[model samples]
Target: MRRTRRDPIVTTVLTLLVGALLAGGWWALRSDPAAPAPAPAQAPPAAQREVTAQHSRQADRPVPRTFDRSAHSTTDPSSTWVIVNKSHPITPSQFRPELSIVRGYQVADPAAGPLTRLLDASDRQGLGFKIASAFRSYGYQDSVHKQLVAAQGEAAADRISARPGHSEHQTGLAVDIVTPADGRCDFEPCFAGTPGGRWLAGNAWRFGFVIRYTPENEERTGYSAEPWHLRYVGPALARELRETGAGSLEEYFGVPGGDYPPVP
Candidate 1:
């Protein structure tokens, strides 16, 4: 007996079904097993950076050159003028004279209303202090500077004279205290020698005043010791400066010592 031939359609259907099953099994077996998980994304860098104004300003600032103490002449006597070489030059006429009083051929102005009140309070406490000089004109400084130069060499004059606009007097916030004879403007050794000077040195901050130049800060101020000179920087700031004993305003403000004019 002869076997019967199967139908072509049925044979094709069976062959396709088997192939599908084999493909599925092969894919399942070949797939990776126990694969590690992917890592997390990294964070972006910070957008902000820290910078200080002082650091930026330092680049533009002018470094002070070595001064020839012997070569420079003092203020000219024949000419009545004041000129500040540091920062810029300023004339006496530019100063506000309305807020000041004249004493010993120099101007004296209270720093502000609050400071004046404080000064009054100090006076009531038996401090007995008076402002000797304030708000000097460039012309006045020039004439005096020249006289000092004539009397002494440039170095000595620089120790005592402030070039015009650079003076704290131009800011109307500084004063010179009167000594016992007015002739003796001795601002060294110790302010404690006089009652007024002593009281100021102790309590000037209460009235927004500070010794402009101190012995320790001679290099920063570009001048020798001066205990008579007082600068008004407000009670809060003055108190801070006094406590820190940082020497001069330049140092307190982070300015290079050589940039400021000599203490006059």
Candidate 2:
């Protein structure tokens, strides 16, 4: 009976010793500096997860569309984007556009409202622009060309004037501006150096107009720099030209210019 009691105590002691050893081993493992940290249980922050998902979704979507270049006909004489140069003459020399009066000058009917707005905006800025010339019929242009030839000789006249059939004025979309009050700066090239000229160069695009014969683009436009000459191509195209840095309609549309086409 004593032997059996002693054996039970021995067994209990052995069990306690084993449990202590196991517990001590676990502690030692946790204290070891080289031991790997347990994987974190908490998920990523909500904002971080959301941003990652957004980036993934954006990458899966197709690229957005770009500006439509074919929004208008570039070849049609009556088109707002028509690129008229020595090479691209209006088909019928006698073609006349519907006209409207804007600031005491005749311009295309489509152009009147924009012209008025342009003038008003400039006037608010205290830079008044007067329209000196607009909308020349083929017959009128013919007479002007003859007079210039008579006064300046044919070669000299060609430098400043477009042949009757090839003139943009015939389309009623071109205007010659002058600052009559800001020092008699009329049709002369010196007008470009004046305050009104500077304003027009920088702000005309906002009103659907461009200085058609610029010193930088004379080669492409087939005319000497005529800073006072403004051509109305509508706001959209004017904006595109300005944004894209296209110096002339010829460069924007890949149209050929710089010379009259050879006679057949």
Candidate 3:
């Protein structure tokens, strides 16, 4: 035993090689299966929430299909939606609607009941509203326009009276309302401040009527404010006008209405 001793260097080298081998084997065992590739990430629920919010906004908005503007003819004299203005006149210069009497006032057959109801409602409030003028013929309008032009010049007459075919009264849907009890402001601008006028302004739409010419829309209508002049457009259209806040049929329909265009 004393004669067979190993070299210290050899022993040291052998220990180092064995340690290295052990380290390599441990590292291989620990890293071997590649740690089961990480589970794929999932998306947050935000997309579904955004879609629900978008649907709610769409539900709250108003749909344009609720009312159809083309429901009635705007050019036909008999149509409730007919637009008579300086630019668009009644098709035939002498066109007249079939007339009937509403409380002794002549109006279109379709307008009689609504007009009567309007006046009766006024009477209930101790206000007497009379139909001063309704359903004027082409000749009558011509005469009225002529008189106004002669008395006050063409510029002034254009504000108060419409030309023959351009008159809404020719359609039988227009009425000049007045208070018979006092006749103080009949057909005058002062009437707009009267009780009857105020009531009509606020409530005429209930009976399918609208003040055809208004101070707010005089320029577009080619006339001055006429609080007493009402045009029956049927309840549906009247409601639409009120809801949309349209000043005149011309503005509502995107049509020209400042003044009569030159005759071709």
Candidate 4:
């Protein structure tokens, strides 16, 4: 009987020792920092391809185009981007643009095709608009300025006529649009509300033109509102001005334009 009891006790002690050895082995595996982690299951090829396509679609979305504001010279007389005002005069003081006749009116050669199309487009809409004046020579502007000064004093002339060298008409890219059906408000503020004027204001940019002066920009342009005056700056620049709400070239280009510097 003692032998049987001793055998049972030895067997139980062996079993406890084996259990401790197994526990130690498990602890060693868990505590080892250099042990390799089990690799995760890979996704199926189809699912991987679907994820890649989704990412490609997102990457393919087009970004909005940014406008480059410095693509042209704002001071070059022949550049479409020229910004002429009271304070900024054409270089050489007598520079004239190459002229081409469009609808019996003279305009810069580059402006002819666009002006012709603009007029034709207006006509298709039944708008009675016509180009009244364009490409006035420096001498002609001088004569006009003197006549204005003679009739209305220097102050009034200054308000209506751009000083001889400073006139945009001399650039050959500026035009005065008028309606023959009603001559009374041809150059008056009331023209802004006319059918043709309203059409030009809304769509001129598409054809490379801008209403150079408005009541909102009179102070900046150093002139009274001239809804009738349209300056050709090419479609790209004109579209930019229209979209940016830039009131005048002076403001858009960040150039000086309030008035002529006091003469010595």
By TM-score, who's the top model here? 4
Reference-based TM-score of each model? 0.54, 0.73, 0.73, 0.75
Q: What is the lDDT of residue 236 in candidate 3?
A: 70
Off by over 4 Å in 2: 1-65
Stretches of candidate 1 off by over 4 Å are: 1-110, 179-186, 243-245, 259-264
Locate the minimum summed-lDDT window of 10 residues in model 3. Answer: 44-53
Query: Per-residue lDDT of 192-225 in model 1, one digit per residue for the tens?
Result: 4666667777877776677767778776666566
Better of 1 and 2 by TM-score: 2
Against the correct fold, how does model 3 do in TM-score?
Answer: 0.73
lDDT of all predictions: 0.57, 0.82, 0.85, 0.84
Tens-place lDDT per residue, model 4, 1-264, is: 454455878989999999999999888879997777767687545324434544554576565435555666788888778888888888878898899999898899989999999999998998888889999989899999999999998888988788888988888999999999877789999999988889989999999899998999877888888889999988766866876889888898898888778889
lDDT of 2 by residue, 1-264 (tens): 455455878999999999999999889888998877778799765435544544654576565423446666777767767778888888776889999998778898877888889889888988877888999998998898999999999878877788887899988889888877865667888989888899999999988899888889888978888889989987766877887899998888888889777679
lDDT of 3: 0.85
User: What TM-score number comes out for model 4?
Assistant: 0.75
Q: Report the poorest 10 consecutive residues by lDDT, candidate 1.
A: 45-54
- What global local distance difference test value does model 2 have? 0.82
| Candidate 3 residue runs with Cα over 4 Å from true position | 1-65, 262-264
Full ranking by lDDT: 3, 4, 2, 1
| Steric overlap count per candidate | 11, 0, 0, 0
